[model samples]
Target: MNSNYSAQEKNFATALLHNLWKYLLLAASIVATVKIIFFGFDIDE
Candidate 1:
């Protein structure tokens, strides 16, 4: 029973991490888009 619970917990943690990374990437892209819209796309400067 304890082992089963541990396995479930581990799976939950893995899923949480996966979702966290997904959201982080989404947030980063949104921030980048906002920056480009406000600042213009001046990569050289």
Candidate 2:
């Protein structure tokens, strides 16, 4: 029950996983910047 992925399928799956990681990193950075701008706009202390 664990032998159904061919070489092409494996490559595609690996590429998809890598692409997901890249997008997640980009999203995280964007969210962090937005949060800081909204909550820490006044840094006098």
Candidate 3:
């Protein structure tokens, strides 16, 4: 049915957005770790 398809489409869109956010967070975390390592922050802390 049209309604069922619509709901499935909406769920797929939500999942895509969720994955995008997850990747963004992972990238940010990696950048932060790199920054800290470059600054030698881990040696003291």
Candidate 4:
């Protein structure tokens, strides 16, 4: 029973981490796009 509980806890943690990274990547891309739109970026300069 304890092992089963631990397994379930680990699964939940894995899912949480997965979602966290997904959202973080999504947010980072959005922020980058907004920054580029508003402030612009210069690679050649």
Local distance difference test, per candidate? 0.92, 0.87, 0.95, 0.91
All candidates in order of TM-score, best leading = 1, 4, 2, 3
lDDT of 2 at 21: 99
RMSD (Cα, Å) of model 3: 4.0
lDDT digits (tens) for residues 1-45 of candidate 2? 345567778989999999999999999999999988877766633
Q: What lDDT is obtained when candidate 1 is compared to the true structure?
A: 0.92
**Root-mean-square deviation (CA) per prediction:** 3.5, 3.3, 4.0, 3.7
lDDT of 4 at 7: 98
TM-score to native of every candidate shown: 0.81, 0.74, 0.64, 0.80
Error of 1 at 26 (Å): 0.4
Q: By TM-score, is 1 or 4 better?
A: 1
Ranking by lDDT: 3, 1, 4, 2
Task: Point out the worst 10-residue segment of candidate 3 by lDDT.
Answer: 36-45
Per-residue alpha-carbon lDDT of model 1 for 1-45, expressed as tens digits? 699999999999999999999999999999999998767756645
Candidate 4 structure quality by residue, lDDT tens digits, 1-45: 699999999999999999999999999999999988767546434
lDDT of 3 by residue, 1-45 (tens): 699999999999999999999999999999999998978976777
Candidate 4 error regions (>4 Å): 41-45
